[model samples]
Target: MPGILGHRASLPRQLAFRFLPDGTDDAAVEWTYHDLAEHAAAVATGLLRRELTGHRVVLALDPGLHYIAALFGIFQAGATAVPSFPPTGKRALARFLSIVEDCAPDVIIADTRLADRVAQFEAELPASAARPHWMFVDDDWFRRAAGARRPDGDTRATVRTDGPALLQYTSGSTGDPKGIVLTHDNLVSNCRALEANMGYEPDRVGCTWLPPYHDMGLMGTIMLAVHGGWPLVLMPPAYFVQRPYRWLKAVTDHKVTISVGPNFAFDICTSSITDEELATLDLSSLRQVFCGSEPVSRATLDAFRDRFGPRGYDETSLIPCYGLAEATLYVSGKRTGSAVKTVWLDKAALENGRVRHLTAEDAEDAEAADAGRAARIVSCGEVAEGHEVIVVDPGERRQAEPGRVGEIWVRGPNVATGYLGKPELTAATFTARLADPGDELTYLRTGDLGFLHEGELCVTGRLKDLVVIAGRNLYPQDIEHSVRSAHEKLRGAAVFSVPGESGEELVVVTEFRGTARQLAEEIDAVRDAVTAAVTAGHGVAPADVHFAPVGAISMTTSGKVRRDATRKAYVQGTLKKLTPAADALPLSVR
Candidate 1:
């Protein structure tokens, strides 16, 4: 809180949070530096009336200034904050309860819009089960906060640095949501590290369409603005989903310097926008477009730059980053103002744990002759100043060579403590040391595969999702990219591994917009082309190519494909497959 409200000697005195509800607007709700402290103080006093001190409180509010103030208020009241995706459906409510059970929160704060769903969820819990008290944001609460007998600013003067700040739950892509208990020190450390790595400027205006519930959205943009003393414009992820142009227009309208989002968002802006819609976007003011939260795609960056370069968007503004919720949302990022780096390599050599740079002739021949498609790896960036990013050979319990692929391990002051209520799992994942007797640093195994090139971090794929066939190790992302590039039908699809008679095989699961009846022959063509493109790209044909309904392919709240559960559903024959009758379709993992 010191960095947020106080210590503003050299920082800019600007608006704290500007709430942009949608993409197009004539005006927005603004809170200046003084306004934020006063409102946050009032919000904290309201929490005290609910007796939330030292208790775990769930925040399920929509993305806005209220949510930002509520977060700081939770800290002011000494309550452990647990931000969750606002329950939107039956499935979402079930997962929301799962998080509640894991964190054991006492109070849940949400918008009045979600009162019905919250009430229904509470009624369904067993008599003996734990249920959190719901505190909806109604008109009365606003009045109470505005007239609150405000708490003293010095009340949290002695807050412990190691005290639990919040529990950031995983998105449940690999498994059910697991809570990571991060301390105050962890949050401050990571935020400061981001400020340093990103070359923070107090005068810079920040913007983000990321949802507040996710780690990158919560800590990276919203909190970073407060802690670093900068102005910020906030918008909802739903708005961006509906109108991708609004995201860029806000940056243009506000002259934003730093903005954050994943790679797919860039792809959507490039592909989904119409010629008329693209005409309104002006991104010349954007300095750094922090691309992260999933695998960074080189093609996505290239497409976005090529599409918008005419509108004064600098190609160097696109900065690739890599990190996870476990590390407080930032591990490594490229230097500010540097051009992005991408390397072309031989696909076969990539599978054998080596990076053999592809010459211009080799790349052209691969693309033209169909002998093999060259693999393009984008460097996330050089490691942060105070953080150590290592490539470890999980099998040999040692560090991998400079150019060899291995599991990514990280160690820094920014790393969070172990997951909540899971001592054994925490030790196994969060506290691992190298086999060398002289080293004592404990690194968090990222469960991701990558290598170091010229001291830059190069991410390949997830270890659990890595596919091995015929003595070759293949990254599913490489295959997924090939399928998507081969045809538009496979865009935004997922590739995973399944058990095979030989070793492990590839499974491509995706959703097609049209029905079997509407698509007819085109659907059949897509199936054959999917198998063929994968064979040419990876040197092995997919065991099966699944086409399900638009919503059948489940994703986490933050939009990561749930490959493990997808594979399990495919094995159990539960996916609602289309283009072929379910029982008639011939599909098997082995």
Candidate 2:
């Protein structure tokens, strides 16, 4: 497959963007390959004139056509593109500043709308930090850049397809965000892998509401569409969050055959979409609806299918997959036309680092289907072509047994080079060798825990996020899921282990909906329900059940709950407590 810019000349007239600003049909603006190429050329020329060809150019633009063009423009200019969203608040600003400090980019791209915010953030940067040249994407700036004629001797920089093109940043769900160095080859390889896994068809259209800064959005949508030469419908992430139905409505309107989102996206669409909204959607055209970027929930998939099945949404469209920033984007995904494959494993055996089958028939034979004892593990399909995926015992640095849960290590063309500047940390993470003899490959040690069954990968949980109590391993997602189900008003939950007098104890921080009066009224009842659920479901009671207001839980750009950050806030006693007494309840006896 050709790199992003390589497609411009051949597919100049090819439909590139059917962008819906308001996530509605009336506000749609169409852009072709020619339009993108022309816009990108101007930006590239501007960067070249500024002599930033070999420098890192941070894209702190909004999520739309201008951002997309600036990204490709950086690529065309032979500079490293550092994709990022504009900072909205103190937390987001802090994260943005961290990226700037790490990359030390020579230029930062933005629009006039964010001029004030960017100025404020730049002013706050330490005197030691390098001040980047800010180029706004507003009318005045674009006109200046686009209209300026290049010098007589000046020519387009040789875009390095095989060299470093992007410094894709991690979501910092477990720790501080790190820049993942991605070359054009790596991006192309992943896009080709996705095309192979999710077979393409004629007139295929893609839709995504994912944030453009993330890999899944950058590579999966914009880059993938360019690689596949297909049209893509894009909407702002805020629009999707505010009205998820708009995502589906765009799909229906565009005849979208492929789309992608995280597990929470499906959950929101399932819980929030109204009956009238559901009736208006016709998802029959969708053949591939990827649910990834976080743990794929079986319940979320089932609910989405059940709700939209009547409206022509097929269950097979939901492809539960796995990938991380280290491996570019795609690692493994279910192939097109294949039914969703799942395995029911004994929860206890899984916690012990073993995979024990608790098949569907076994549940039927039992008097009652106990979800607490069995976990449904979804298949992320076979490893991408030309890629090798192995489950390795992280501690022993050896290949794990066939049915054992361990860290997922991958080696392939899609795997990124390493972190931007952290050589020692990058070497440790990106270069790992198995204890097995005769294996010369150095794998990217993905900190994800999972096992392989019949060539399909089944992700269990994060290796770092695993909660250990009395030497027993527990997955926090299970506990969080149980807490979410504990009350009707509960929104989101973060489960983690905090230091205790004896050992690490479980702590629960959950978000609740409704007014302050309602929260004060339901605090005790909700706490009791959560305690009972966690104890009964996971056999471990939470040390502190902190009921927080909605949106209190820290989340990554990709909608993943930042457990580590939340834990830090919780430890510092900074997390807001919405309880009547403003105190976390101790483990209550059910």
TM-score of each: 0.93, 0.95
- The per-model lDDT (C-alpha) reads 0.79, 0.85
Q: Lowest-scoring 10 consecutive residues by lDDT in candidate 1?
A: 581-590
Model 2 weakest 10-residue run by lDDT: 581-590
For 1-590, candidate 2 gives per-residue lDDT tens digits of 22455556455377888888888878888888887776777788888888988899999888999888888888878899998868776776777888888889999998787776666887777889999988878656766766675766343577677789899989883236689999889988998899898876987999998999998999888999987888899999999999999999988888999999999999899999999998889999989998899998887788888998999999888788899989999999987778999888887888888998876977444315553777777888888898999999999999998778999999999999999878998989999988778877799999999999989999999988999998878998878888999999999999999889999999999998876667766667887899999988787889999888999999988989989889989999899777544343333421
Candidate 1: stretches off by over 4 Å: 6-13, 116-119, 126-128, 138-140, 150-157, 173-175, 200-202, 359-361, 500-503, 580-590
Clashing pairs in 1: none
lDDT of 1 at 216: 87
Model 2 stretches with alpha carbons more than 4 Å out = 1-6, 116-119, 151-155, 173-175, 365-371, 581-590
Q: Candidate 1 overall Cα lDDT vs. reference?
A: 0.79
Candidate 2 overall lDDT versus native: 0.85
Find the candidate with the highest lDDT and give its number: 2
